[model samples]
Target: MEADYQPVSRTDAECLWASVRERASDPHAGIFGPSSISWKVNRESALFLGAGRAALLQLAHPWVAAALDQHSNLRNDPLARFHNTFRVVFTMIFGTLEQALAASRYLYQIHTRIQGAIPETVATYPKDSRYEANEANALLWVYATLVESALVAYECVLPPLSPGEREAYYSESKTLAALFGIPSHVLPATWLNFEAYSRGTIESAGLGVNDLSREMAHRVLQSKGTWVPVPGWYRALTTAWLPERLQEEFGLAFCRRERDAAAGARLWLPRIYGRLPATVRFTGPYLEAMSRVSGRGVGALTRTSNRFWMGQPRMMFAERGLGDAVELPQPLQ
Candidate 1:
């Protein structure tokens, strides 16, 4: 590990969790509730449109790419990776307080076991430089990509957020970042600062797409071995949304044909997407959350959608050992 890098200690995680939990107006609604900009923006199924872009951006980070290549089964079971990623994230955003906290602890536990050295020198990180999943900087980068990409995808089909709404959304997202064990001190103070940080990081040597990253990107975009391969236009949009440097590094072609396809999507998607039914337009977790708020509990239709989103009828927190019985460390006074 680098001498300057600080992994998120148990103390840090607990303190952040307590701070966020204490501020929740509706514990049953989780950290961010129905009124939150996070829900208003993230509830839309259209955000999945930017999922490929987010995955590619994450792979551009050498540490992230190395971690996934070395420790994850992403290549063998790409759908599992997708389901797992959304499972944790949706749980954090839409699950009840206990569920969200359980998911946080589960994620922290998983991160504790993921530490390895990069295989080759990539930009600022030297070969053999160590990476821990709980490292603040790396976690922050991944958090930023999700936040930015969600907004980018949301705006594609819906109206863009006002400047104030963007700031509020970023503010709420810091609590989600806390779940990742990233310190508030390490995060950008505002949405503008966050944007600047994201742009700067992408342009800097901190983000180096290696051969492994390129392979991972291909795997994520191609969906090989799956009955449902990614659509050509969606792939084009993903490639076009990336930074030009990263597009080149990943060898994604944005030829005239791809450009036309992407353009056509930008023209047609919004019109068609707006007319989708609520069950189809909103994610399962979001619907489940609404059910909770309405006192209806999770319905059969919601459970079916949950299976599609998370590969299970429910989050299965207890089955996964992330239940109420799992104890959290106490925060310091």
Candidate 2:
């Protein structure tokens, strides 16, 4: 653990309420309107758990696993990486279009430097076959994973969406994918297609979990160098949320006590979370965006950002791109 890393405290959150209260309902600031299912679902705090689930799904993809193994220092600096990723995600969902575009550009710049041949081939994909970050298939899988996990977490922690709302959420997610430079053709046209695509990928031999993916999943679940000490219940819930096929492939283990605890959390946590005050439940990106539209200084709101949230970092990491110093950890053999 980094001695210098400070966990976000309750005091930090106390300071944020004033800013949230003063936030404006800016109609033109964000891509997803307040009425959109994307905004309603993405605003919740439970997505922090969803992010872990999504990362595992992405890592399980052979191409994504190779890319991250070769390029990311996530194992060495999990908190920093997670913070950077979360900032990008929440910004796309809640930041103004300009901010979302900026975050997307930053991501694209990073991905541009991430091209390389797979270290090991699987099924049809041979080793030494090159993969680029902008590749449509890989990008689509990554985007789909996040969107799917967000919905999973949303339904778990909030009221279940109506059938029509579910479709709207999927449709709105395409806009999010577009912001990240994913081509329209790559995205599934509907919620049904997305579900089928995700299932095919998960069950496909071509995307089976590898050593690299398993190691990364272990690190996330174990909370190694994690910003906050992940609770046992949280770990249990996230593991339970993972696809059963993946659990077996990744060798995730849980005892009876843990399973029982997870079952309890699955039953009660969402209800409790849904009951939280709006100021407490909504994410910082949402609040900051509202501040911008409401004519309040976003700086004040940002001070309390990334602090006091279960999923947020105690200390924020600086956003980085291609030229930034990245200390890639030793690749999983």
Candidate 3:
């Protein structure tokens, strides 16, 4: 809500650019400090906001402001997309919208979470060092990106809003909806798909919590290291059809008991999936392979974006001495 936005100092910007690029690899060694994730977000705020903060004051809604304010996490820790939506929003307001969009590109690997509805996209490190972005995480990322981008695009088309307006200070749309616990459903029925998967999970597992409860519906959005917690259940269920040796390794009983017992389950993972073949260590779980092969999985990463540079922005943003200057940053984000 304040007009204090500005690009970060060059040194700060450089540091944050590195941190965000290294998000998956940042260590929890504490050397990076306790607030590394928030640090990157703030630095990005400065980088993207630059001198555009005041000019963009008319653009920020309340939820955007809050997201910029509340980015606390280690750089490598995984966070819910909804939890970290503001940093991307602010970057675009400042004309450096590239960062926001690019971060989404970096997350292409996580195409579906919560059955392609809830995305756990804004994953920071440390907390997520043990977790990999899985189906639910991917879904969360796309869902959040679509909602945020659409909301901003909406603002771009409407008459410019003014300050001192109540909606100007707070998000009346998506973020506000999420805050009241009535908001996340504003999404299309892809959300219903998420609900069905969750319900099926609970029922098949003999879980009795209402399908709509936060616990049952969103639990698959969690993880440990590179493994997705929700899909472990899928694997466990299907493990019954696996050879007995695989069943022993997959340990269907432990996975079921862990989630049913209300534990974070990462701590109990040895009982859940510690016995699986190491081939899955590099490749994710077998269920994901099924999703990929069956056409329900996240899409593979592609390098075609590099081709965008040859397009016209090169001429528009180019300088003569620099030679052809159209550029898109590396997709690694």
Identify the candidate with maximal TM-score. 1
Residue lDDT tens for model 1, 1-333: 333587899899999889878878888778898999999998999888988898889888888888888778777777777778888888889988877887888788888888899899987889998888888888888888888999999999988999999999999999999887889999999999999999998898788888888988998899973555899999999988898999899999999999999999998999999999988899898998999888987788888887777767775452335432322221100
Each prediction's number of clashing residue pairs: 0, 0, 31
Model 1 regions lying over 4 Å from their true place: 1-4, 317-333
Model 2 reaches what TM-score against the true structure?
0.80
In Å, residue 180's CA in model 2 sits off its true spot by 1.8
Per-residue CA lDDT of model 2 for 68-126, tens digit only, reads 77787777767666766666777666765545555555566566677788777654567
Once superposed on the true structure, which residue ranges of model 3 sit more than 4 Å away at CA?
1-11, 15-260, 263-268, 283-333
Better of 2 and 3 by lDDT: 2
lDDT of 2: 0.67
Alpha-carbon error at 262 in model 2, in Å? 1.9
- In model 1, which residue pairs have backbone atoms overlapping below 3 Å? none
Q: What TM-score fits each model?
A: 0.94, 0.80, 0.19
lDDT of 3 by residue, 1-333 (tens): 112222222343334334443433322221122233222222111111111211112111221212222322212222222223332322211111133234333223221110111122221211111222222222233333333333232232233334333232223222222211222333333434433533332233211122122221122223322232435433332233222432332223435553454333223443434354433221221222223235463223111211211112211111224433334321111
- Can you rank all candidates by TM-score, best first? 1, 2, 3
Better of 1 and 3 by TM-score: 1
